[model samples]
Target: MDHGRPKPDLIIFDCDGVLVDSELLSCRCLSEVLAEFGLQLSVEQALELFLGRSTKAIEQYYRDLLGQALPDDFLARLRARVLETFAEALQPIPGAGAVLSKLQTPRCVASSSDLDRVSLSLDVTGLAPHFGDRLYTAQMVRHGKPAPDLFLHAAGRMQADPARTLVIEDSVSGVQAARAAGMMVWGFVGGAHYRARDGRAILSAAGADRVFAHMSDFWEA
Candidate 1:
């Protein structure tokens, strides 16, 4: 925590881009799968549209664009490919493990991804031990990012007041959700997926109280 900001009662982490560097891998896999279903998106476009969203969001996106429902099997296919790719190549964000190791604040994961994917991401990156069963997912809420429901849910479950929670996120929607939930948020831009864009400005515009590029700077003011 920074000296300028009140120490948080609890910290809520968004898994994909904040804890695990899986945004690029997941987005590329999503693009490949969507192409097979007659929807095309470059990896950059996929990241832009779905970086902090759920599979249900993806399905609805394609449904709106193509003007019909995606095949019932679409989410299943996407999840399988993403999990397989994750098991093979996912890694934690740079300095993520060290930060978690040193932090004394109570913390938990609340991600837009499913529990299965969030669990596997942590396990493969050697980050699972830090969270244990404190992981939360979009499946736990009726709505996902850009909606305040998920973050609010996590804060309640963790027994922290929403106003006293700190949300660390790497996407606009995540930052927005945290703000909507009345929590202070720091926008993280250290993931491989952010290397090509101005993530700091984007997240700041989305209402992040702080925007930082590396996990090593997590406590800096």
Candidate 2:
């Protein structure tokens, strides 16, 4: 542990943009699927509206925005599309492997994605070995990001105190959730989706304790 600064007893990670460069790809696919329902959005817009959110929450946002519920099979179709796309396109965040390999403290993944998506992402990116079975997902909790439930759940399961845990996230919702969980947060901006976005400002405004633009910084932090 780096004792020069406040070292956390546990380190929590968000999946999509933090561990994998899947945000842009996911947004692209989501935008395409949303168009089927007469809801049109560009990839960037989709990322802005739905990044770090669960599929359920994404559906709710669309429903709330359009004032109508999606078709019964809409999410099913969307999920299938996502799975296929991920199987072909998913990649890990640059330098993420090095950081994960070098980390000395306890670490785990807590993501808004379901277990299948998380597992597939890790497997596709060749990062599964680094995480093993230390995966947490929104499906495991009653609430998702922006609610603090998943992070708290992961910390509790890991036997780490909330106040002593650190979270690395790449989205506003994830940052808010970490803060709500009483954990220190670092906003990550190294994913492809963040290159044209001021993810630092967005996440910091949402209460992240620090902002880092690369996975290399994770090792230093």
Candidate 3:
């Protein structure tokens, strides 16, 4: 614990990269789908552009780049493919369950993914019972990560003072959102998606108060 700051009353967790190790899988699926549409993005490029963003971001990106809406079935196809892959490969972040089981602070998931997607992720990874109905998604708010809206909404719902809240996230946008919400934020770089990246530096630059590479170091960091 960082003795300087008050202990958090509530811990807000980001679902995709932070809770479930689904970032790489998601980006890869996205790349494949986009390629079918003649959009040639590698998994790395997809992660660079859409990590921590919602499906709305995908729609906007398609429109911005092609000057037209994505094919009407784009989201449906993407969702089906991603979910199919997730069912076969998704796993909770290492130590996530152990940490959650022992954590004393009140916590909930706040994700940029859609409600159905986030819910399914938790369910598939055996993290659903830990959160129950406490999952909050971008679809619930007008803005998602990097906007402060989602975090603020979660804090309000959890009745936690933002200044005393701690957010565990893995994306730059998520770190920025937590800071913008006036909360303490820790960047987690344990997911497979971060294998070759300097996540500590990237997240620190995005205003995370602390950055750690594994959930085993969560409290110690």
Candidate 4:
């Protein structure tokens, strides 16, 4: 007997903190970059503003923070540093690989990060081969997370019905995007960036179908 097919036709995963433990590394890299300009920012501040956003959005945020225009090449330098740091220490979140390996449904990665960064993270975490050609980036959509364009774009590209997709996200912005795209959302709370009360509130306000405190919890659910 064919188990009557799984519930969701597709499973879309967020790359950064959900699949790879790169959130804190990203925060640290940006903080170090800002320090070069004589600006100091806490990890929490970086997470609040930069997590789940595109590089362009992150550049705009620094532009506002510095009260002046950033050099056009600033983003390039930042990207290089982030990539180097991630390559040196990148690892998958606890149980991430096992969970992915156990899934029976078609899976795809949809990330707010640029294609290069997304590819690098997945490569380091050893999840690149698992996804094959099913990677979707914010550049493929009209807008990033908090807009649903990325998730919708991924679903459309996969030819999967949006109603039958399940989005696994670790940020409120990502969860909101998936919800707006008409897919079920599962909020991942096992990452370092989402340890605060505000993070929990954001997940709730965004209407996550379920909040998982651990990878095992998600797998069990």
Candidate 5:
């Protein structure tokens, strides 16, 4: 039964859309925050521009658009709102818990979110025990997704050979990053946000080796 490519030595998962169903809430918050700055962004637009990107990248984009740095309290306020919202509304992706529980490969989470947000997402969804200190965030690297730095850093730290690592991602930037890291990559589109968005198309365009639409459908690597 074991045929074709070599089995993976490690698995890497992205957080928001891949592990937890937080993208809809996060994009809503992004829409709200950007509206205050007179940009009038819709949740779909926010998802297009900010999904799988770090807070620093988002802030810099806003600054570039507005021609000035954001207010000191902007990030703090956003974080507070997002954390409160997560405590109340965040949920794990459908079947993600069962999939993680059954997975035999050593796995870790690597996300564009900062450590605090990543930790809280895992905590709220009961996925924390699955990963614990195995979490890696873009803040831990010099560059985020689409640049290969974060994926390379995670693979290096996990002691996984890039050639034998399997990456599961839900965004274009994340897929690009994992592929650039010299690893096998699959695109996941299980998040509710994909209902109205064409995430799979973008993921395919970004060069994922395979694409799956549900956690239960994840391929064995």
Candidate 6:
């Protein structure tokens, strides 16, 4: 179909699963925290419930699971653990660097994760130089993914036309947010979150223009 010709002026990438292989890190972090409460959660369960959500949502999940609020230091401890884990292993997705280097248009990263986590992930993956000051964290926006606020805020900051922007995402909520912001949506299916039938179907039904199984397949579309 020669889908490469109609290139957009800006490309927004999700940070976790799209740029770095942090889905497992996320699952492990959550599992470890929940396990301290005597609750066991599988990676698959964590991926299904927690991927693409904010830290607050995750904290609340823990609170709900334990029937009590997490300690005030819970977030800080979790952040430290996740940062330490990611620092040791923040491998970039294959072909991501090549694709970023080849992109002629302006590019930025808009992630549902907080600024600190986003910065750490990008830095560890060596993608920090490519993004520069173009990193937009969802915490700055009124709402997170599935709300379109974050994507719209990012487009505004970049001064890029939403209609001419392309968003690469791995979560159904992220895809829905991009579509709501009037941008072309490309679903990246190489993440743990989309491993299930329902997750895959949800993304497709959310109106992703295309789904990519790998970064190499992204150029094909």
Q: What is the C-alpha RMSD of each candidate to the true structure, in Å?
A: 1.1, 1.6, 1.1, 3.1, 1.7, 2.5
Assess each prediction's global lDDT (C-alpha) against the native.
0.92, 0.88, 0.91, 0.83, 0.87, 0.82
TM per prediction: 0.97, 0.95, 0.97, 0.91, 0.94, 0.89
Candidates in descending lDDT order: 1, 3, 2, 5, 4, 6
Of candidates 5 and 3, the better by TM-score: 3
The better-scoring model by TM-score among 1 and 4 is 1
Model 6 accuracy (lDDT, Cα)? 0.82
Q: Against the true structure, candidate 5 has what lDDT?
A: 0.87
* Most lDDT-accurate candidate: 1
Per-residue accuracy of model 1 over 100-151 as CA lDDT, tens digit each: 9998999999999989999999999999989999988899999999999999
- Report the backbone clash tally of model 4: 0
Q: At residue 48, give the lDDT of candidate 1.
A: 87
Q: Write the per-residue lDDT of candidate 5 for residues 131-169, one digit (tens) a residue.
A: 989999988999898889998898899999998998999
Task: Tell me the tens digit of each residue's lDDT in model 6 across 1-221.
Answer: 13553678889999998998898888889789768766688878887777777787776676777677776777787788899999987788777888888777899999988899999998988888889989998789877888898898999999998988999988878898898999988878776455554545667787888877677776674
How many Å off is the CA of 192 in candidate 5? 0.9
How do the residues 1-221 of candidate 4 rate in per-residue lDDT, one tens digit apiece?
Answer: 01223489899999998999889899898888878766787878888887788886776666776676766776787889999999999888898888888888899999988888988898888889889889999888778888989998899999999988999898878998898998888888788776664555678777988777677766563
| Residue-by-residue lDDT tens digits, candidate 2, 75-158 | 888888888999998989999899988888899999999899999999999998888899999999998998999999999999
Looking at model 6, report the run of 10 residues with the lowest lDDT sum: 191-200
TM-score of 3: 0.97
Q: Candidate 4 clashing pairs?
A: none
Over the stretch 1-221, how does candidate 3's per-residue lDDT look in tens digits?
86379889999999999999999999999999878988788999888989999999888877897687888888999999999999999999999999999888899999999888898899999999998899898988998778999999999999999999999999988998999999999999999999998998999999988888878888793
By lDDT, the better pick of 2 and 5 is 2
